[model samples]
Target: MTATPVLVLLDHAADGTLRPPVRELLTLARELAGDAGVQGVWAGDEDVAAAVPALAAQGVTTVHRLATDTDVHLSAVLADGLEAALAASGAALVLLVSSFENKEAAARLAVRTGAGVVTDVDGLEVQAGRVVAHKTVLAGTWTTRCAVSAPTAVVTVKANSVVAQDAAAPSSPQVVDLPVEVRASSTRVRLVERTELAGSGRPDLGSAHVVVVGGRGTEGDFSAVEELADVLGGAVGATRVATDEGWIGHDAQIGQTGVTVSPRLYVGAGVSGAVHHRGGMQASGTIVAVNSDPDAPIFEIADFGVVGDLFAVLPQAAAELRRLQG
Candidate 1:
């Protein structure tokens, strides 16, 4: 029996460079597709030529470049393009990087095509010809394995969940352009202006493999936290209290009301582990907490906990890491 082709939504930057998560998705797709092969869905207006080499290296056999008249930023517009790509590629399974926009696009695609949709999935596998998605629930307290009953499934996978590897034998993938008819409803809301955020010269908080976070215990000083993050080459995040106090930009806040992160390693300095804050990062692979208060709530869930002043602990830890790396 031949495996069905799997399609991965290629998330790229404005300059046509593929994002880090797309490689992971392509690796997973290659495993699932087997001999049936893997295809890619490119929705952005960027030139697809620049991404061909990377996609081919990941064993993608073909790339479906969705050409749409409307802005693909709109979730509805992206869904319309995805529907066309599914038909073009004849792929029953689609993999996407989990994000607010991608989740919205996945939901809309599910409604339109009767495809089962799963978001923030950490793992996936085929069981008895069915795609089973594994995700955490109840604020990362419980793990659930859900099988998609529908013929088509759209899954948004979390970053750092799988290690991305290139195929042993690369393929020269052919790019096929498919024109999509934009729905009038999707064009109802026009995007007025798009502003790009200034680069922080650090990994993105939502998908970084390692993250260092600060809380109220930092006492409005993130120098220690920043130095540690830089040493580890990780993103810097802040608790709501720290952000509300104007210690860091709100974009760096991580919680239920802010950005959710599921990094491989999470380091919390002076974080008390509020329910809202824990809800965002509890799914991380390894949790390390450092706080002066011995009774801090974060210590309860931390895989490793230290009872010390963050100001004193962080610098020492960073220095030790630097020495070890050298």
Candidate 2:
């Protein structure tokens, strides 16, 4: 009999390395599996199975490697490979990160396997006869606990919500052969030139221990906030408005439509703080807000508040932090 598997989605980067979202999902997989076994699935240029040993510290026992190559990058192929792996491994659950590229894989995999699919779950627990995960609804105002409708469940969890669990020892990932079917579909998005962004020497937003965010209230300049983030040795974040206005990159946006993060500390600058935006970053362990206006909504959630303009506060804070560090 095949061993039970809990598939964790793997992110293949331009450098042919796994991204943190995949590791985050692996950590969650270990949480759900507990003493149970886990098997990971990845469809990419190289075998993701090679990284399984790193995941084993979190209790992952096996890795399913898909050797198929695709002319078009579609989630269908991922799901196709997953079905084969699930059937072969007898997985009780499959874990995924809530990302655009992987959504189709989770959706199609569920349909093909007749499994219950859950999306954007903030937390997971075992209750009654099924597994339960919490989902925030109505822009984080209402929280709902959703139970999986099937014994075999498919889950898409938000990024930065879980800790990265490590595997045992230095054992490398054992490779398992996967079966996949390549069919001609209208969904043909080809892979073009892929490149990595220049390293800013900041931690990843989704995985950072600390995050510093700025918004429209920054008065169209974030040099102050950026310096403060550097001082804190953390990643910089921005609101949707900052990204929309091109004040910051889209990757830096923090909101419902942006990257979800749960850091030890999060500092907001000049942000009024909308519910949608808060829905993503509210899970942060601590919140601090600096704004010219005391009435900004961000101050309500902030553990520390400074009622001053970000432009004035950030530079002073940065300089002070540098002096303190010396």
Candidate 3:
């Protein structure tokens, strides 16, 4: 008996290049999909042609391109396209990169299709013919495993949950255009104007494999934190205090009320590891903390703790890393 295929929501950059997290999702999908094979759902306006080769290399046998000219930026509209793709592909499971926007899309899709939805999942597996998703809850204090008993399941997965690997045997995937009928209600809230933030050379804070965070101890100076993050080819984040003080953009804030990250490595510089901030990143695979205060709470959870001034320690660390690379 052929297993039902697994579908991945393909996210891409403006240039139509597939995002790194999408590749990770595809790799995980390949593992979950045995004989059923892996498929992609492309809902963006960018030309799907540019992403086909990369998708094919990731073991995707089929691409369900949404055949619609309407804007899919809205959650409801994107859900419509996803529903069409799900119907055409007969995929029992759909995986998406976890983000605020994608969580809205997942919820909308679940409401439209009666599918079970799980968000911020760090791990997924097929157990006893059921899709089991593993995630943290209650401010990362509790870990839980949930089984999707519904006929169809939609899961939003955290980045870096799996390492992306090319298929042992690649296949030239066939692109199938699926028609979408946009509901008028979906367009009720039209986007007026969009302002793009200036690009930082570093990776996105939410999905980066490595993240460097600064807190109140930075004293409104993030130079050391940024330098280390840049040296490590990672993203820079800030505690709420840093943002509230206008030391950094609110977008960089990482806390219970801000972005939740589950990167492979987390480096907190001058951060006190407040409950709100720790709730955001406690799930990281490896955590390192640097602070002048030996009694800082962050030391409690850090795999490696250095009781030193961040300004003094971070630059030395960056210099050493650069020298070693040289």
Clashing pairs in 3: none
Q: Is candidate 1 or candidate 2 better by TM-score?
A: 1
lDDT of each: 0.92, 0.75, 0.90
Task: State, as a TM-score between 0 and 1, how close model 1 is to the true structure.
Answer: 0.97
lDDT of 3 by residue, 101-193 (tens): 889999999988889999989889988888999998876778999999888999999888889999998889998888999888988988787
**Residue 119 of model 1, lDDT score:** 91
**Residue 194: error of model 3 in Å?**
2.3
**Top-lDDT candidate index:** 1
lDDT of 2 at 108: 83
lDDT of 1: 0.92
* Candidate with more favorable, higher TM-score: 2 or 3: 3
Q: Largest TM-score belongs to which candidate? A: 1
Off by over 4 Å in 1: none
**C-alpha-based local distance difference test score of model 3:** 0.90
Model 1 lDDT per residue over 1-326, tens place: 13789999999877788888899989988888999999998987898888888988999999988887788888999999999998988899999999889999999999999999999999999999899999997788999999999999999998888999999999999998889988889899888988768769998888899999999999999999999999999999999999999999999999977889998899999999999999999999999999999999999999999999999999999999999999
